[model samples]
Target: MKLLKSKWNFACLLVSVIWLASVNAVALDARKVEVRGLFKNAAILQVNGQQRMLKVGQTSPEGIKLIAADSKQAEIEIDGKRTVLSLSKKIAATFSEAALGEARIPAGRNGHYFTTGMINNQSVKLLVDTGASSIALNSIVAKQLGIDYLTSPRYVGVATASGTTRGYRVTLREVTVGGITLNNVIAVVTEGEFPRDILLGNTFLSELDMKVESGVLILQAKY
Candidate 1:
């Protein structure tokens, strides 16, 4: 698969733009806090095996207050201290929390902002594309992620560097990069291999505040 910069008719409008970008992984204390699931402005947290759903700014009976949340992680305040937590992982020691709702990506060796992130809890490489209207990937990548794209009801034609091709429109359960995450993201899966890199389109970027400084791409949650 070769890199191509072209417009997409379905959900992507990728243009010829380069961003020089990078994320530090964070771990939380598992015994005290365990994130069961994450969603927009809300999270399912299990404190001592008692699961409770908490919305932003709402405190649970266990004294855990949801501050901010995305598909990747949830920020909760306990005892007047805030820390982010992700899915089940045994963090034997306490870890530092990232900036509230913020993530930074540094450019790769190719001068493009490439980062490793999760699509439906499966890890994949992402190439940031502001021009694209929605996240885009090829069928191969979709299959690798266990996405049943062929069963989708929505099918559309997408414009790519090669030409227009058949694609499927689907909603991703979660898309995450660093500390920033979003859910129900729109994406297109093309039939053939073209977009060698998974294009992190506006469907995800529009939900965040983005800016570039000193060749680093910064993304922060809008909420």
Candidate 2:
């Protein structure tokens, strides 16, 4: 009976030591990272070249949890199946307009200029409208740009194809077409029933030195 009791005690100690070592290993393996607002609910966390999905309310087997604070980036797990969620103050800054798209005037109709690129990470078609006083995005275009039109602040008395209509005025953090990037762009968000997608109005054009000749609009970035 004494020998059996000794064996049992040794086994329990071994198991406890092993469990603690496993926990420590997991802690040491976790990597800190920053998450952008692009990810919601379920996001694949990439750390040290490895990727893992972070589900809300669930801690990684290693014991990490992911919580979203805002559009800015946040810290996340890097390695191992489970880890602890650690917030890092060091996060990647949002992209500037120049960093978002390339610049080049593409072919278009009616002597108007066209540029193709991503707006809010989605493909968009923009028409250069010098006549327009500000950038105008149709209802559909605003949705595509991920602007929460309904909750957006109201700006009354905007003219549209349907005549003067209620609209929302918002500043796009960045607008990039071709190699040009425009920041703090004023965009008019029309009501649900709008006709066009997006019209690049003078709000953007006026910022540049442009000349229209032979059906082509030349734009020069002004200092």
List lDDT for all candidates, in order.
Answer: 0.74, 0.56
Query: What TM-score does each of the candidates earn?
Result: 0.56, 0.50
Deviation from native of the Cα of residue 146 in model 1, angstroms = 0.8
Could you tell me the TM-score of candidate 1?
0.56
Root-mean-square deviation of every model: 21.6, 13.8
Residue 88 local lDDT, model 2: 37
Per-residue lDDT tens digits for candidate 1, residues 135-155, read: 999999999999889999999
The residue pairs found clashing in candidate 1 are 21-105, 21-106, 21-107, 22-105, 22-106
| Stretch of 10 with least lDDT, candidate 1 | 18-27
What is the Å distance of residue 173 in model 2 from its true position? 1.3
Write the residue-wise lDDT of candidate 2 on 115-197 in tens digits.
Answer: 54445544466777767778887776787678876777668678666688888888887765544557888878887656474
In TM-score terms, which candidate is top?
1
What's the count of clashing pairs in each model shown? Answer: 5, 12
